[model samples]
Target: MTTTGTTSKQREQATRKTGSQSGQPIVAGVRSDLHTMLLPMFAEQNEIHDLETVIDGCRIRIRSHDAGVRIPTFMDQKIMMLLAAHIRDVIQSGGQPTRHINIDRREVIDLIGGGGSTGGSDYRRVTERLQRLHSTKITAETAISADVSRRRHFSWIDAFEEDILHTDKGKEVIGLKISLSVDAFRWITQGDGFDMTRERFKSITSAQSSCSRIYAICLANLIYAKGEDVYIQIEDLRLRVPSADTLKGFKKRPLSKAIELISASPDMSRYLSVSLVRKTEDGFIPLDGRAPLESVYIRVCKGPDALPSINKLLPLSETGGDTRSLSAAESLVELLTDRGSSAFTDTEMADMS
Candidate 1:
């Protein structure tokens, strides 16, 4: 699927706007447990099977009909944001989920951060996406007690209707209403998920890969759910990426690459403090171990004040306006040293250097 330049820009702009709003309602909080909702970057072209992952502690597994696991693309994710934001708004207003949520076609476009009138190619695209979202299936389970547990199965939406109206401006699908599946409604209202802020959403949308987006979201979920800095094992991060189990799916090297991308991005680091460390049975292991890199760790930084020292280290590169061999290693060493035990050791530092 080759997305045209126009379509790609639209996606990026919509994502950027999500995090720009002020104190907005639920911009669509994906259920944290639905870890594999979005398909991986490399495998987006293929059909996904029974994708599964364990987010936090709950296990979430998804199986689609013959339609195959609909890997929620960037645009599809925006649709989710709209649904999530609407549900969040409804809940905050002390209103409950009705049988159907009616939205003006123009309103829908605005909600999704798109401009221009809602007609032509834009309307068709939005309509098709809503249908696709409705058809995707998922099953989520979490333990209730030592002997009790709960299971939920449903699609992202149950059904949708396009309300056509003939107005002076000509015929148009002025209104669009989507019926929420019971499970989707329940999860939106009662389940646990990250309350994505405009800034956080912007960061996630701006990320370059499936793993990078997953890493950022998981980190946000941890902070939101725990109300403090959280530590997630590297294995947990690896599992979050859909189709990442086999070598063809995803591997440790790609996982390392993903973590590295997050660490390198200034925008991502603003909302979440990310770092990669090695740990073994004996506790924190030296990076020099011939043992392959096991996992990456992530944490959400609490305040803007936490950034200055780390920011200062970037200037140490002294590249003299050259593009290649910018002494990234030297800067990394300084950055890690500043971060203390939370970053790599001398051996790891040399390896990176």
Candidate 2:
């Protein structure tokens, strides 16, 4: 039986505020054994036809259905099928999976092809604006405007410099992912490895240091087809884009933590906000079906409330201890909001930097 649960308690504990007073209910807390409800669906689904094999300790079950697998109808079949698919997954793609990464600055480089140009962007102009803002020569608006104009230069590059700007012209949609130690220099110098034991894969390198990772990602998104053949470099760093847009008709292996399975008929997933978590039987449900999932994930987005005691933080809370709830940090933000000109201008950021 496969089981999954929240590894952290940080998800719950919400604090909400109505109007004048902020409520303290604590933010959402990730319940332990969140996998309890999830594992059974995988293990005992009734109609699981292919049960001959097992992999990674999970029983293998594979079957085809005319319509979607109904949870109550083919419970066993679903479980066993999902298990077999899971095994096939391990065998086919290798073991386990890397969930999330620390999103280090180097990961940014890795996205753009570490040892190559960051993007086809004119970093020269961006840098010049930064220098100007730093010396108080121009306003932040001027710098950001310059940056935006420079950004405007980005478009689908024609077949001209396709060979040279291959890495810089688009966002490198990742298909494989791995974690690296938190050293940008070493990670950049020697490059991040796929398999540290045998050094199975070498990281990509970038041609320049000043290139922006965003540009590379945008470019890579356009150019590369799929797989490790498309490599990128930031400086000396190299790595494969480990993400890919989920393919069509691909039945995402049902997750043990999946509490709900919303179909593709008219996906309402995209219409929702990130703060709206799909309360499912599975902890993390897959948005795999004919139509793309456009669901908003809430519940999980606790930090957006920030420290503000009003709308965001308050809504999550029921009742509050006003003294403890009051935030000096949020107070500063509230002051800024009251002042109206809230956004940090590019010039201001550059000057501060």
Candidate 3:
């Protein structure tokens, strides 16, 4: 694996050069299936021994390698997103991307919007989050089509090494050298992925509240709905999104707060609209205007501008005509839609909030 680093001067120069470019920021592609199924949007303090849940038809199992290590949190997911953006840049530059990547600590700080300084707290935060990502295990089993089913076992980071230098300055922490698991690498580089603007990504990741971060990701992935509404059971959502709150608490506070934030943000609302609803024998009813909190589902509808262009759907390849590209696109749609399992009647759409 090749290790790379940059001094503060070099970083400044790179930043200036990036700014001088055509003003179009790089777009990162995150694997649709993994984002929706494997990654949890909320943070957790308690150690997770073994967690198993089924989303759509896919069965997911998560475990921590050590008793002390916790599952990857929303912050960890941000790091993964940054890494994915870097990999995309590499591929676009005609460079062969690898699982082992070296990222400067300063770069990570910038991504997380932790300001320019790489203070002790920032250093520890980056290193500890990388360690947690390295220690967690994830296995997902889902059908690709009517006939094909696949099971994959992988971690976010297969290995992590911190670059430290000792000299007249005593000791200097350089950066991080991490090896992404093979599955993770493929997911970013080859799988059916969706494009997210770097600006939008930064906005969501840098939010103060974890709920806002979680809601943004959930809403962003709903672009696959193609301007249609997606109704997910509240219980099912609680299962996928790791939260400390009970189901009732989740519905009352975190979920509501998230809805408020997303609704208020122009960047988020430009692409999707969200609401809470109750499913009944006749149809779905919008829970609005002081309605009592009850068992309800989240209804996410894509906005007019939410669909991706043809170019965004394909992976960054030299020829841009790889056979796997089509399969990837198809797989993404299949996995996210739950293969019709979550489908509802048009009557469920009346008086949508």
Model 2 lDDT tens row, 211-232: 1111222122212211111111
Q: What is candidate 1's CA lDDT for residue 285?
A: 40
At residue 83, candidate 2 shows an lDDT of 21
Candidate 2 ranges beyond 4 A from true positions: 1-123, 129-284, 290-353
Model 1: per-residue Cα lDDT over 1-353, one tens digit each: 55323343443454354332212333343222222232221223235545666554445665546464354444465655456556656656767545367654454455454354554767776776676666667655556579976554556678887654443344545446778775445434433343454554555555544655556444544343333444444454455454355532343565556657666766555545544445555444434534453443543334333321211101223213332322332222222112223333334445445
Best by TM-score: 3
Q: Each model's TM-score, in the order given?
A: 0.58, 0.15, 0.73
lDDT of 1: 0.47
Top model by lDDT, which number?
A: 3
Weakest lDDT window of 10 consecutive positions for candidate 1: 307-316
Worst ten-residue run, lDDT, model 3?
Answer: 18-27
- Quote the lDDT for 323 in model 2: 29
Each prediction's whole-model lDDT (CA): 0.47, 0.20, 0.61
Task: List the candidate numbers ranked by TM-score, top first.
Answer: 3, 1, 2
